[model samples]
Target chain A: MSLIVFAGAAQFVGAGMFGMGVGGWEIVLTTFVLNFRHFLMTSSLSRRLPDNTTKSQSALAAFGVTDETFAVASMSRDEKLAPSYLYGLNFTAYTAWAAGTVAGVMAGSILGDTLKQSLTFGLYALFIGLLVPEMKRAKPAVTAALCSMAVSGALYFQPFFKMGSGWMIVSATVVGSFIAAVLHGDENE
Target chain B: MSKLNIIILMALVTYIPRMLPMVFLKNMRLAPWLNRFLRFIPYASLGALIFPGALFSVNPPAAAAGGIIVSAVMGLMGRSLIAVFASGVAAVYILLLII
Candidate 1:
């Protein structure tokens, strides 16, 4: 918890100046754009947690859910458990992420643009890693990937559909999911 | 407010969608439709991320060229993570200088 707080706060203190070219709205939009996955993950994990929670906490914790936290919370742990377990999982994950932000800042000075840029691929790699394992057991995952990639490629070159990069993802996800849910689905799919 | 403040503001706004559900919705059931919708997130999320980076430059072809090759090669070869990240970055960096 302290680490993530430090990292997030430290980022503001350090490179917050880089916001000139990128407006607050743009940054905010992109932030929503970039981490939109969390939203979907939350929707899924909600079912995994306790069946009751207040709107306020839902409003608050929804902001913190990440792919990792979602995975941790969603994992079948013996059986249905308390929401407190999810809270603890989230708190720990938040701390780790915020810590990374701070660590990223310190590392930023040393890491040049190329390396920094490459590091962004870590997310990409993580997705691939996760998908690879899932796909091995569930063919639906493979179908989803191919379908999404095709959609992505189609949208990438379209001129009039300049919906920006973020929305494109939302489109692809919806399309892909619908296809998977409807096309090649068993109960698990 | 300072530009830095704006970025921080953006970060906070971005953090909201991610953090809110954790604290609040941790123990709720998503509607069946929404649950179905959630399955596609990883695909969309990953696509959104990689796509933007590809379009980050005017010379999209050349800029993203190296890293794409590197990642593909590493994946097909089933190489280690370090090699995957390092080679991909190096390929793009080297390509950028030459292009």
Candidate 2:
């Protein structure tokens, strides 16, 4: 059980580490990029927080501003966001995530190694599931995703450029994003 | 580094971006281009994540192909994340069992 917890924590500690070899700096940078969306969430939610909210309180609240928690906090009916409410929201979401991870780890241990190996594909499938919704919504998403796929695939297989998975992923992300931003305009496609 | 160390590092990396804008950049306005670039980051990153790795992650080629196809179809159909992912994994697992 302790081993499972350690293994689970090692792998699922953050979305960025899922299904990848663990290199310290690579993990850190990949996580930073994965959670970069939080910048927008925090920016939006921070404004809703009470103007006089202390820096310490704001920082504390910011720590918990994940996608789910941010959505809940941002959707509150009250015009003014209370620090207490933000804290409660964050606490609930964090507890749920932690508990869920523990539950999964426990269940996984019971299932043993063969099934666990098969389940590794689940993470990749989940990534695909996440991307498809956005791709459906935006033309640029489709373009960028295809571009990323092509770039990453080429980097992985082509003998001339032997890029590591982490670096390849990051480079493809940058290129895809740059191309998407250039091609996508406010005007309807 | 140890698992605990990696987790802590993940926490720190995750925290910095979430903290910075709320702390110091609350009043600052980002350039329009930069905002648009950020807008597209998630999709692009997720894209970079899925390819080559996802397809090649599983064995036999058939299993990975089956899983990806099922997941892609479910996702395109607007299914929930869980449903889409489960279907994919299930497809792969079932395929493995048969072969």
Candidate 3:
């Protein structure tokens, strides 16, 4: 069960990170960044909660503010959300995510080495699936992606200054985001 | 790090963002520029994850390329997650069988 808790972030991007030889502090840090949107999600949902909600209850509700749960809770027709309703949404999502991971990992254990190696591409496929829609919608997004790909490729394949995959990923993220921010800076305009 | 350490760190790091705004920054507003930057994170991170690294995920390089092409096509076509994943793995699996 505790292992499954780590799996909360697994299905999304954790598998890819793990495949890249990422472990320990890097995994924790990457998970933090990946789930960073929860900050915005929780902030918005907080406004919908009843005025009398207690700190403890709010903290408890926040624990379940994943992307999926936030979407479900925010779409409720109620003008003011009760803690119980939010808890229900969170509980369902948490259970499904954790259960699925446990099932996936258990299944993976029995896979032959070659089968496991091929299946690793599933992680990259997941990442590409997440990317294409955004890139199609926005030119800036496409540019950012290309920027990241080029940087990551160079660092990954560089013979003289061969960089660790983890550092390569970190650098690519920074470079790509910087390009996108510069290109799309006046989004509010 | 140990599995225990990773588990603990993941929980702590993840919990902070989830809990902080709800309790302390409930009313704090993000700057528009910062929000815009945040929006790019997914694309940037995913892009980094796929290229170069993904290309080398499988041996015979050509098989990996084939898999990526399958993934890219399915992804651009707005296929289901399972479809995108299946096509990619299937392409690589087939390539490996042949070569």
Candidate 4:
């Protein structure tokens, strides 16, 4: 899954849904929605790549455009992004991700049930860890997050509106971000 | 769908967003409204992923809440991802042990 999906959040969400026995389409749809941010990152990074970069090279590098890699690439002081640099960066990050998954699996096998159950919260911790920084950085981020929490909470808990987790996430994200975009108007960053 | 089939489809969907913009939309600029919408997706999606579900993730909901609070506090303090994540797991473990 790590080698194929190559996305942390999507993999985590997919694993959780799979554990709960959700349908395959739900997993696929949720993965797509969760990973849609890659479009923005790759679109922004494309401008920095040297004009002479080949299509194959760009395609290969695109597979590695995780948030961490994008941040490192975007922070480079060089005017033109070098293909070699990108390849190296992507290679390293990809290797680490795959290797980390292997390590996690090995550790999981060794861990007891109680320890494993406790570790379930690690996934939520990851989301909160990633979101809280953004919430603190901008008021609009807070608005978007709060709105999403409200929508998803309702969708999950309300009998009338009860839906699959996949749909719940998709709807909440769309409505929350759309409201934030309309209300904040992109000025606050 | 079979697991292999699901994995293949996931690969395709994941690749689309990463590949299309860099390969085909290289020179194009998104409209301002669309860009703003995309910009907010991460926060919104992360939020949706965290709440309500997180509460039920573990046996005792309070253990999960403890993990969340530790994570959020460390995150707000701008701690490293590993620190926040490990501390959160630790908090849950401790809470579970107590309860």
Most accurate candidate by lDDT: 4
True-contact fraction in model 1 equals 0.32
Docking class for candidate 1: acceptable
User: Which run of 10 residues does model 1 chain B get worst, by summed lDDT?
Assistant: B51-60
DockQ of 1: 0.30
How many Å off is the CA of A78 in candidate 1?
8.6
Model 4: pairs clashing at backbone N, Cα or C within 3 Å: none
TM-score of chain A of each: 0.69, 0.52, 0.50, 0.60
**Tens digits of per-residue lDDT for model 1 on A8-111?**
32244234534345455655555556555565566555554455666665655555465555544443333444556666776777776767768987999998
Query: What are the runs in model 3 whose C-alpha is more than 4 Å off?
Result: A1-112, A160-163, A187-189, B1-27
lDDT computed for candidate 2: 0.70
The alpha-carbon lDDT assigned to residue A52 of candidate 2 equals 77
Instruction: Summarize candidate 1's per-residue lDDT along B1-99 as a digit string, tens digits.
Output: 565565566556556656555555554456665565565555444544455444443243565556665665675566655666567666666666667
Top model number, DockQ: 4
Q: Write the per-residue lDDT of candidate 2 for residues B1-99, one digit (tens) a residue.
A: 765776677677667767777776444567766555555655666677678877777777788888899999999999987899789888988877777
Question: Which one wins by TM-score: 1 or 2?
Answer: 2
Highest-TM-score candidate: 4
Tell me the docking grade of candidate 2.
Answer: medium
Question: How many angstroms is residue A161 displaced in model 2 relative to the true structure, after the best TM-score fit?
Answer: 5.1
How far residue A128's Cα lies from its native spot in candidate 2, in Å, is 2.1
